[model samples]
Target: MSQEQHYTFGVSTRAAERLRSLAAVFAPSTEQLLGSLGKVEAGALDLGCGPGYTTELLQAQLSPAWTLGVDSSEHMLELARARCGPKLDFALHDVSRLPFPAPPAELVYARFLVTHLREPVQLLRAWSTLMQPAGRLVLEETAFMRSEHPAFQHYYAYLAQLQAHYGQNMLVGATLGTLCEAAGQHVLDAGVRVREIPAAQMAALHAANLPTWSQDPYARAAFDAAQLRQLGETLREIAAGAALAPAVSVGMGYVIATARPPALVQG
Candidate 1:
């Protein structure tokens, strides 16, 4: 699939602004995940790193000797470079592809990335080659989401459908451990972390993202323009604190695994 077709979300300025909010909302959980790594000698690779927020988190939490943020969009990479400066590196590469331009890393971190790719097990296997024999692989993905509000429910349903049309899974976190095992990694930890997100926070996120994908071929075909407009208005109202809604229950699946050592050889 072409790059445009691969990712439903556009890299427009609004999308970048959404990413900033995304980083703030998810930072604590991501920091907890990184803190579990303890120490890193070689450095960390932030796969699908948009705007370098996660890279900044890694540097702050782990103090890795070096850091590299990788993404497919040059526009995002440019933003990442500007945000991170010379202290960290940013590479433009489709993370789903193997043979990344950078060297092996001691830690590979991907947040909300696998859901956008096909054959996550294969992708995990390929990622192992980018890590040292004992390097750690960390991932955070959406397992499922729930909300009492009709607007949130409708938005998630349509978003899931749109992602499925592109051969991706919106709730891939449920199978993260199995994917790691199938990829030959030694699983360390795997479980879901549930967070109650305020309606305003989630509404802001959804509002920021709606414009990026509302015109997608799949979205347009599945949803009426009037329906999308109403959804957008509701989201904006909630985001602006003018409307009230129940908190959203988000189930985030996280996994920590290590590459199995190479087999021993005897002459």
Candidate 2:
């Protein structure tokens, strides 16, 4: 795996639970994006599928001939396989690399995946080569996040810094459309979907992720252990409703693009 693909949040059992909650929180927007595609006869590929919630969504929404969920972490793939039906298959592969184990897909979908990539435009170009001529490339990533709570704000700042250290961008969603165009794909649609998540829910998500990320070498070096502990406690309090805060507004940018014919690809 490339250094850029080193996910800061380790795939612990707690992280899997965090991902499940995250999938629930973001499902509506993801469903809306998939609905735009209607049905795909060829196949659908879910990149960085985590515990496979998004992969399940893809199957339900598109009912493609086949569905494959790929992730870099084998532990995540194991968790995904345990819950998924026979129709859904999970593969252990670094999504940032090319020549995936499966065949070319009719619809390639990734949610919160590109933010972890160093060369997102180049990866997009590689993905286009693995798609059918008319295949659609769908991406959903974080454009920005806003919260009134100091703990939440501080947590996001730390996350942004850590991702930057790994050559990734926490706010890569804002550039998805431009990246697609640069990759030689035809942009069909692109826009931001803003969602308001309850402070309690957001806190719970962060609390789950805290244990894993706070232990990272960079996080440990850059942040004080006592500060992280205090932040975790605050997040837990908010999650339990013992602390009150306003909802968090998150902006998710989505882009739907189609692979251009081989002749149309830029040199």
lDDT against the true structure, per candidate, is 0.87, 0.88
Candidate 1 has an lDDT of: 0.87
After TM-score superposition, the amount by which residue 178's alpha carbon in candidate 2 deviates from its true location, in angstroms, is 1.3
Which regions of candidate 2 fall more than 4 Å away from where they truly are? Answer: 1-4, 261-267
| lDDT value, residue 66 of candidate 2 | 94
**Per-residue alpha-carbon lDDT of candidate 1 for residues 175-206, written as tens digits (9 for 90 to 100):** 89999999988788999989998999999998
- What's the residue-level lDDT of 245 in candidate 2? 90
Give per-model CA RMSD: 2.5, 2.4
The residue-by-residue lDDT of candidate 2 on 163-266, one tens digit each, is 89988899999889999999988898999989999999999988887788766888889878898899999999999999999999999999989888444654
* Residue runs of model 1 more than 4 Å from their true location after superposition: 1-5, 261-267
Superposition TM-score, candidate 1 onto the true structure: 0.94
